[model samples]
Target: MTFHKEDQVLYLMAEHDLATLDTVGLKKDFRTGYDSGVYRITHKQWGEPPHYAQAYFDENKHLLLFSAMTDRGFEQLVEAFNAFGHDFPAEPYLRVNLTMVTTANEILKKKVVLNEYHDLFQEDPDPESEKVLKEINAFIALVLPDINAGRTPGIEAAIRKSGIDPENARNVMESVMGSLEGLPGPKGKSPRKSPGKSPVSGKQKKLTKQLPAQSGEGVRLLSGDDELLFDLHLYGMAGDIRREAPWEYLFEDEVFGVQVPGKDLVYFVSVMGFEGEHQALSFYKGYEGLAGFLEFRAEVGRLSLLGLPDDGMLQASTMTGGLMTIPHLMLSFTDRDDLEKEDLAAIKKSGARFRGKGQWPRIEEIVPGHVPVYPSKDSLTELFLVVQQVLVVLEKDRYDDQYLMREEDPDHTILVRVPTGKGPRFRWRDHYLVVDPKWGETSYAVRISPASSVALARLPEASQELQLDLFMLPATVREKGSRAYFPFVLMMVEKLNGLVVSMSVLSPQPDLESLYESVPQRVLEELIKSGHRPSRIEIRSDLLFDLLEEILEKAGCRVMWVDHMLQMDEAIMSMISHLS
Candidate 1:
């Protein structure tokens, strides 16, 4: 990429598709013009470092654009867009176009015209605007026959004539351009439509009552009280939530304390033990009213808040327990009401098994519209697709302790945190979950870091060694062989966030206390000598907190403690003093 001052032009060309261009290339002839203050570059390329550059201007000489000179500077800009393989606008000038579109009419006009030059280069969609673009493109394709048949020449003109506000003209133009790509003849040759009857309308309807309203055909309404009252049952799911059922329905003095802007006239859907004994929190903060309940089984809670669309006929959200409750089943009422006797019987059986445990609320609390009922034969096939979109594993196989699953047989051998012996034994909540009768209860949700989940799943070693074993196994089997006993040990190690060592040291041994004392010294010496950073050391299970404190003190290392509770970090200068 090069910028010329005397020519008053910005030039961008790629060496090849894989080029990671860093520094801006400028000919020596243009250097003098720039040195003498004839011109400057501003916006840098993706891989370039920052450099002082003057702005480019249009024919009127009012600041038009700038180019970046340093490779590092350009890299920073590209990093902003390409981080995490996330979707981002491919055109380098997209931000510029957006700015122009919102700022000045002449600039906006220039941007649309420039789109013709760079249209082929554009790829990534704006997460916010993609749906609108999708709808527009779909509508255009649907009406393509009309366009090709000479019914319309310029859809942009038709949109303008339909009274589309000038502010939204850019979006209208994109839709028009994408659709017009398939039209016959030159730009001016197609049938001309009057700009008097705008093809695009002026303003989108106000979706104040919900999050940006989706373009899906119909709308269903329900009261918060209704969803709150329904007795939703999720059993045989992972987690210990059923044990916590006693905690779900804590009484609140007030009816509704929180308010969503568009949903002011709403009631609170309070589950007893999920929030606190008496306090109630909204499912996903402010947007609770847009959907019935915020369903958060995995890290889906975080993604749902960002408004990512789920890949089902419909997606639903509700709150449940963490690491100890059964997964809450989101029900859609449309299918449930339409179910035949056998299907209804199967649903009621699953429902009875989950809710009969006595923690589920009365049936009347649920709103009477579309909800996620029990998985049926047809829906089960699509279950994985829905599950992957709405649910994510925090740490892949972190549950190897409580539910060790075989790599060869995921469906057959995996022991999730669902009740084992049958009967209703779990409690559902908006935020937290509870499982009862302690023995067979399981967690509906679990926690794992996003970083660990992605990278560690690929290593072959993880698949063979990582296992989940229940800690609270029957006393009769406590002294069983390693095959039976190791699971409990695995559960303990996982709970405390300790690593399973290759040496049989941490594996259950008869003289446990003596085994523990000798292992740490050997491990610590080996770890330090192996050039391991302080952060990477696999601490001894029993000494996780204690040894961490000791080593930091011995090394005179300053440490920062970030609590999992609030996820807030605090610096500790001396571990000895802090521990004291």
Candidate 2:
């Protein structure tokens, strides 16, 4: 109706009347006769941009019964809905639908009121907006007949016709159907609604419970030798690497290589410190070859630009020679709880400079098999030892032949030093780390396993179903003198009613692996404690699905990966507001 020109004008004129209508009355009049959930519809006109509209019913409030037009308007409406759970201050929220602009007063109100409306096209019209509005109007006209007849709209076909990807079109239709589930079909004929089923529920293929065997071949594991390498790193190796293999002499594009004796692999290292730049050594697996190095180089270039301080005292001080810019590798860790006393002492003695409130430097090791982590004392020591070995190779003249070869063929080969054995008698042999000359020849893969499969098996299946989500909160938490980090939350809510069943917050301190590995067990504990095994669990995150799939399936629970979880999202937004 609002799409009609005369109705649109009338709606604008009746803003006061609409505002005067209580939320209950408005719901009774405008309700879509569907369960509470977000429904999206897209309209596209010939030779015009697409416009989107989303309508939702709020389970927690009386208002939130209106439809939003355009992507920006939809986003604003969602934000306002989220703000309703908290004691957010009242504010005016504006939305532009087609040519009409409406402002809502007390946007945080449980029952929202439209303050006023105006014709945007009449006063300072934007050509782009007008064009988009026209397209939206055309799309509305196309779908109005189906909507009035209570028939499912041909949204997917329309989307496909508009040149959208078939898969994306199917996803859009899935959302629409999921939201329209249990609603009446043609001629007000009610569809068969499954008892206790969620409004957003949909049929999903059952996932296999048995996990594939993880291969250990070609995978590097942390061993005692690795510990030895980290120990070598702690004995002033970073400074030695900087002095012996300066990036000024060895360009970032040139690779300095290292290989341990009796090992089948070689590591290609790039030194980055070259005055007014990040001081760090980036290592790439030799198996990855030339393209991998190029990719790493490109990522480093992007990081360098992104790492620049924003408009702040740090930027001003750096410009005025009052502060030093430290590499992100040397992140500050003022909290002693984050580090062992011995490691802290070693770091302090290592002569590493730190700024801000952090008293010691922490090394962040990002390797092939593990999550980015602040390495433990032994691990840090091993890394430093490897750096010391690299420094030794750079300083020695025995590797001159390999270095010369690498210099001549920079793209194909790298200078490498292989150690014979550990201990004081360790001897070095010069060699070249060679790779396939062609690009895209190598692939890097890492296998992750659920932390606790046993706990998953012990979970008792229940009759109820639930929506689950694990996400990092936007708000950060930190101790008085420590670096800040966003905390993660694992939440499970009753799928049908949107009631929060369980919520667990985890801190990713020391390393991300610790946090990641702890998730499965936490989910199991929460489910067992709450006495809800959930016959079916729906989730949107690939990470959560990966972590919980095998385990949950073993417990006789089906896992469904969907495009959206209405209840889960709303709950998360409320949690975020409280946290913020």
Best candidate (score: lDDT): 2
Q: What TM-score does prediction 2 earn? A: 0.31
How many clashes in candidate 1? 98
List, residue by residue over 285-374, the lDDT tens digit for candidate 2: 444533545644553454356544332212122111111111112222344466656656666543343334333334564432223456
lDDT of 1: 0.27
Candidate 1 residue 347 C-alpha distance from true site, Å: 47
- Tens digits of lDDT, candidate 1, 1-580: 1112222112221111221211234221122123221233233333222232223323223322333333333334344424434343333331122212222222112222322222322336445344433443343334345655857545555444444333344443443443243122343122223335322234331112122212212321211111111111122111122332323333221111112112222222223334543211111112232122222222354445655445210111111112111222232212234444654454444333322323332121111111223444323322222222111211222222221223333222211211111111122111111111232222222222333323332222211111111111111123444322221121211123233322221332342233333443433343333332232222212222343444433442222322121000011112112634
